[model samples]
Target chain A: MRVVLPAGTTETALIDGISAAGASPELMAHTPSADAEILEYGEPTTAPLTPVSPSGCPTPAAITRAVREVVGFDVTVVDAGLTEPTGAATVDLDIDPGTDVRTPTAVPDADAIYDRAHGFGASLPEDDLLIGETVPGGTTTALGVLTALGEPATVSSSLPENPVERKRRVVDEGLAASDLEAGDCDGAPMEAVRAVGDPVQPTVAGITAGALESGAEVTLAGGTQMVAVAALLRHAGVDAALSIATTSFVADAAGDLETTCERLDCELTVTDPGFDRRDHTAMERYCAGEAKEGVAMGGTLSLVPDGKMAALRDRVETVCSRLGIDADGSPKEETGSNTTE
Target chain B: MRVVLPAGTTETALIDGISAAGASPELMAHTPSADAEILEYGEPTTAPLTPVSPSGCPTPAAITRAVREVVGFDVTVVDAGLTEPTGAATVDLDIDPGTDVRTPTAVPDADAIYDRAHGFGASLPEDDLLIGETVPGGTTTALGVLTALGEPATVSSSLPENPVERKRRVVDEGLAASDLEAGDCDGAPMEAVRAVGDPVQPTVAGITAGALESGAEVTLAGGTQMVAVAALLRHAGVDAALSIATTSFVADAAGDLETTCERLDCELTVTDPGFDRRDHTAMERYCAGEAKEGVAMGGTLSLVPDGKMAALRDRVETVCSRLGIDADGSPKEETGSNTTE
Candidate 1:
């Protein structure tokens, strides 16, 4: 199984009102940022992992470690305009580091990145391909893409309490800035992503579409961002042979993900990490809704045997404890956003 | 089709016998050697192309351009270890840049590179995968791998005149430095490559073997070095569904390619570029025996639809004329290997 993490930034996430991803605004602009931590969580030694937002989380890495224990896989990070490198193995797609999504064209080379990403996807072997992504402000980008694709997409949040008003406001401005009406990109999916979507959306969509066309069973691993990708595929008339997999946290979060997936004709697989009872407070934050999901946490968890969540939680606890993170899921030292902005 | 070009260096190429690759030995140590020119040749404009050997030839670019016209594809250069960047879209595999091949271990992380390359291969779609590689002096490394594999392999040279004695001498030293006898690596393919092969060998072998496992038809698109890759596959017991495509220059050169292929259980496809009557004398050098083959020039030409050699030739002439390279296949200025030694 191949996990493609296409990372990008969305200016919508930086709005002072935005905090749904559980990162303190101050830590959001750091080089590795929270988006990169998802890949960082895959390996054990933290020495080479990119320095993520101390206030944010890379929850998906814990889930991926569990899946890896069951069936080993290769991790390939597609540099879809990431602000910083994950320090892992990455394929440079020649995409510029993304600017905030509120630009005239968020992904100017969305077309080229999509074409080359398609070729990359086409080059993989036929198997039960599992694809996952991690873009820090990805949920907001999903909101723009989904709402643009004609879905009432109330995406889940990394925080337990959804920042509905804040996210909705950002999406509203993004939609207005987009030359496209909601359904304008319903026909040409690439256009919507170009207008307001983050770098990860089109890249993941292109790879997913390419793999599907090649006759491989694909699992889109994430929350609303993947739904955004599915929406792009659904409208492009290239939709088939795909499903969405995420955590119960995402499924239970404020988003109407169920209806969104249903509308796109995409299947959903929700894995419960059972964070409610975990002794490790940092991990248990999933139950409290502090760091609900990012990375392919839910999809990766679904791949492992159901009972393996215990082993997975133990690993996370070990990691968190080693890093001196406390039960409240905050870093030992206050690194709130560092945004000096 | 996915084409992976992994490049590296083994100091052995700096020897006087290595001239056919069209690189002045001095420029051979520089970044973006002749290997990169093959991919550059495919594009119509020189802009966006990586600068290769100033004193060398980019003959393969013309051949690859022809193939691109027939079947356009993305070029992914895997930096197995290069002195400098090729400025092309590349995957950094993070293996230590190789020292001279005579080292006790030429590729420090043969196992790691192999594993990662397999993931790269597995990630490709189930199509006719084209796998190519370029490491100056790779033929000597191929000789090392094949002879170590128990094959009495007499490999071809990049020069018009065979550098048999020089290449054989390097292989002899490489073989002796390798702690095992032939078939020592029959059960350990990665070991053979690590001990006696260049950085490109294991990476290409792993990807080829991985793609084969993924049920993709793979074409080892190079000459003797590819033969080395095939030899590694044949011994590893994981072999299936692959072939070697190269130029007649390699086939008809002073090497027993047919017998070697037969010994390794490798199928070969040799394309005749009809270089005999080319106005672009820079390209006709293949006919006269300069720069035999580096990159997948020969194999890429083989993939083009038959009877288009003239169009391919005209395109080459255009590129040659624009580059100011003349009929003598020599640069206007002399850049004899500036050995600071």
Candidate 2:
């Protein structure tokens, strides 16, 4: 099995209190690069540190890294439109980082990115491919894309309390800026991405489409963001049997995920990852609805055999120790629950 | 099976009458990118035209493309150090194009390129890998790398006459400029490349080492250029059994390839692709020793079933027809042969 993570960025993430992918809005630009580095090298080398929320929740890349250690799967990071360069080895799609969705032309070259990524996906030799994303403010872009495609989509957030209204307001502004109403891009999926979505959506959808065409079983390894991708595929007339895998945290937080999957005729697999039972602070954060799923944590966990759960926990412990974090992902010198609640 | 073609460039290709990879020396910088474009899209998109020798011998990328159409193998072009951007989707290693061998710092970051390529190679899920090259003036650089590592290598050429003494003179000047003896970098494979080699050498060797470490069966998939990569792997302390596959034209031109493989305890497979019997002018050029091998033509042909030879021939005819070439690869309106001899 091969796991491909498409890393990008969107200026929508800079909205105050909108994203928790990094410790602050300024640091959010480094989240994708940091996550990719951690996934490939067991720690971040390019960025100064790993991605952590202001409330001390570690990014879900740590969980995916642990699963890879236990399951021995291969990971490849694709630079769809990263704001920072990652120390990890990556496949570059030569895309520019997306502007804020309200700018109207967030991802102007979405179609070209899709076509090139489709060619790349057709070249993979793996029989099974799992795709994930790490785009800050991706959920807003997802909401924007889904609304443009005439779907009412409720997306999950990395913070403890999902900021549903803020996301909807941003999408509305984006729709107004692009001179588009709901369903304006209903049958033109790439147009929706061009107008409002981040670069990750077209890239992931392109890879999935090409992999499916090449007779490979592909799983969209993400949360409601992947639901948006599935909706795009359906609107594009790709009538394939597709599936998505993600954490129960995302599935629970975004109540529309199941109905959206069903409407798109896609299967959904939700795994708990047993983070609630772990003693690690980062793991505890997941149970609290912070840093719930990114970097394919749920999909990677799904691949781990029941017998390897203990091993996976051990690996996670090792990764956390390297980060010098405790239950709240704070430095050992200041260990305490740092949840916003 | 996967075929990885690493493309790069060197100022040595700009020396008067040194390279036949392009129609003229000024065009040599575009050869690597053009070859990659042709291999991926069945034609050149970024480049104004496909690569052709000064004498009008078409590049072997056409052959590789036809073989792919017949056998259905996956191909990936790795941008080791391309001067031009290819329209083809590629994996970029963030390397600079190599300087002339006469410059002591020919490939300044050879080790870093090697390490990164090794990581990329280890992530591949394929069990069988075929590695090729598309560097103009690569055979001369192969001689440079081999000599630096204490090997006497006789490399092949795209021109009919072989130009053996000219290549030797260039390497001699390079050795003198670097202030080193033939065996100065014997125990340091990457050092050999950094001193007087092209970026493609270290990149290919690093990928091969990483792929071998990951327990994949690998075949160096070009002519004497691949022989240089095998030599680097051996000097780097990789003792695993390896193999190389190429065409008989290269074996005949490079009479020492068999002995060098024997010295390195490696297996060699040389196949005759039956190009001599084909009526296409581009196919005839191989018989006359104009464009013997590049872009993994020999390795790809080795994968075809004996029964598929006719289909392969027909496909090659189709590719040649698309290029507007006749018996000597000249324009159909002017069908005179362009052979130097």
Candidate 3:
């Protein structure tokens, strides 16, 4: 079965890891300027899409294109949308779909999107699965997901001086935005996703559950965002095995790796480490968090096998060679679509 | 110790396995034109050095520069000056150094020049080892070296098809021109080096042996040429541990791997597997005996503490990254000097 990853730049590493393991995957890129926020922070604040050149389509459109590229097979596109904060606020929060979203008093439309995306009908394809995600400020979102589920989640950037205070503030703000009470949410993974989770987490959870029911293997083609999604899946009682494809740089980063793996309960695999070696400072700035940390943490718990590292390295090298770019570390003249939308 | 590798178009992958393990290495170009003659049915002729827009230095000079750049230590450059075919007349053979009027026999004098560059005395600062070589169809000289020692050494180009008949004829002709009988020679590895080996190979072996005697760590940096030099060292009973730094491409290639390894009884460490991956076809060429096999067959074994398969893969990725290259089954762009003299 083929899996598709609608990836951002660093996210490409995860897709490479998956593809290296003999799984067919299509990489659909969102235009560099597409400002679909996957994480929400502080008070409910609405941040409009930045008016920059939309280098590509939104995540939904990319998903559609991916489904089309893999012909002659049943396709399943998991909707992993996320909501941005409506206003400037200081706490972190997330929401689970089935329980919190299902309640009559909750945000009805917000919950409805989750139902539509997560509720798999009998008419959908049986063998294919598109594992995806949406986690806003995911390292913080991961913090929330872990805390609400009663794990001691210490989310910090992978920089030399691990910044725990900033992560704590984001997590606290996220918890405030989420509706589920801490006591009620304790020990329930889905409840955590529902309270502080963004749209992508629940959507991926539903997709994994649906795929498991249909007896298809699932390849989670994302970084930390998928980690949050996997947490939701476990909370929802999905018992399917998961394989994660990601870059080696992330896999090698220091973090609460063992905890993340135990929570996800899946194997993790990494592909090329070169991607993590790229300069992502701008990306980290815009994301309001370190991109490397998220990428690395996301790769930790995912199911990735060994041996494909060399193959993936070769593939990246092949592509770079074609572009007349040097592969060993020298900066090249920028020519491709600028990713710094 | 630092090690520098000249970046040749598509040959970086040839030695990546050894470079990644924190070995100090840099890639530079030797010549502007990438010219190497294709050995076919006739005895292969050496292609003229792609005329340097500026004048080109001799092979020994190029080796000297590489050693200085990579190792950052004093260097003893050995020049193995063998111009005349010591045995019989065969096909019109044109190895690069053979075409130059400076002749391979002038290498000892060249060594004196290198010694002068470093200021030698009765008790000089531990002489940076002598790393030597000769270019342009030097494998034929390797055969001559073996023949002069009374060993039935079979040599072919590292090209895809076996150039056995061509190589045999070249060896016969070169041997016929010399006064040394198959068995009537001094056993010093330098004897073969001075008689027939190229300037680079013998010089490097001499430097390596010299360093070992002085109780310094030594590395032979190059391809099949280094392997031949190592074999000579073993024959001389030098006890210093030796390390060979080369691309993985040469190691996986066929030919005198066993004999080279057995002769040296030392380890070979590859810089990057990507190097081997790209040059597989070329490696196959050498394996098929279409060309004479180059150095570092047991090179991996020489890596201190040895590298696991994973370490090898990591090293490949690291080298490729440093070169600003990737591993996608294609030839990378030449970054530095071209060795096609």
By lDDT, the best candidate is 2
Evaluate every candidate with DockQ and list the scores.
0.08, 0.08, 0.01
Q: lDDT tens string, model 3, B1-341?
A: 31211111111111222111111122112221111111010111222221111111111222122222222232111112223221111111111232211123413332332232222111112333222232444455556566656554654343433344655554454445444556444465555544444444443444455456556565665455565656666666766677555544445553555566555675655543232333333223222332121222222223324334344434434433333233332323332212221
The regions of model 1 sitting more than 4 angstroms off are A19-58, A322-341, B1-341
TM-score of each candidate structure, all chains considered together: 0.55, 0.65, 0.32
Cα RMSD, each candidate: 14.8, 8.7, 23.8
lDDT of 3 at A65: 24
Model 2 has an lDDT value of: 0.80
Contacts from the true interface found in each model, as a fraction, amount to 0.14, 0.05, 0.00
Better of 1 and 2 by lDDT: 2
Which tens-of-lDDT digit does each residue in B1-341 have in candidate 2?
Answer: 87888888887777656675324655667777778766766766446566655455678888898898788766777888988766565666788899999887789999999998897777665689999988888888898988888987778888878887888888888988889889888989988888889999888998888889999999988888888899899999999888889989899988888898899888999988888887666777788888888888888889989999989988888877765665555655422222211
Better by lDDT, candidate 3 or 2: 2
Ranking by TM-score: 2, 1, 3
Docking level of model 1? incorrect
The predicted structure with the larger TM-score, 2 or 3, is 2
Name the docking class for model 3: incorrect
Write candidate 3's Cα lDDT for A79-156 as tens digits. 233222221111111232222222222222334444544433211333545454322234445555666666555543
Superior by TM-score: candidate 1 or candidate 3:
1
Better of 1 and 3 by lDDT: 1
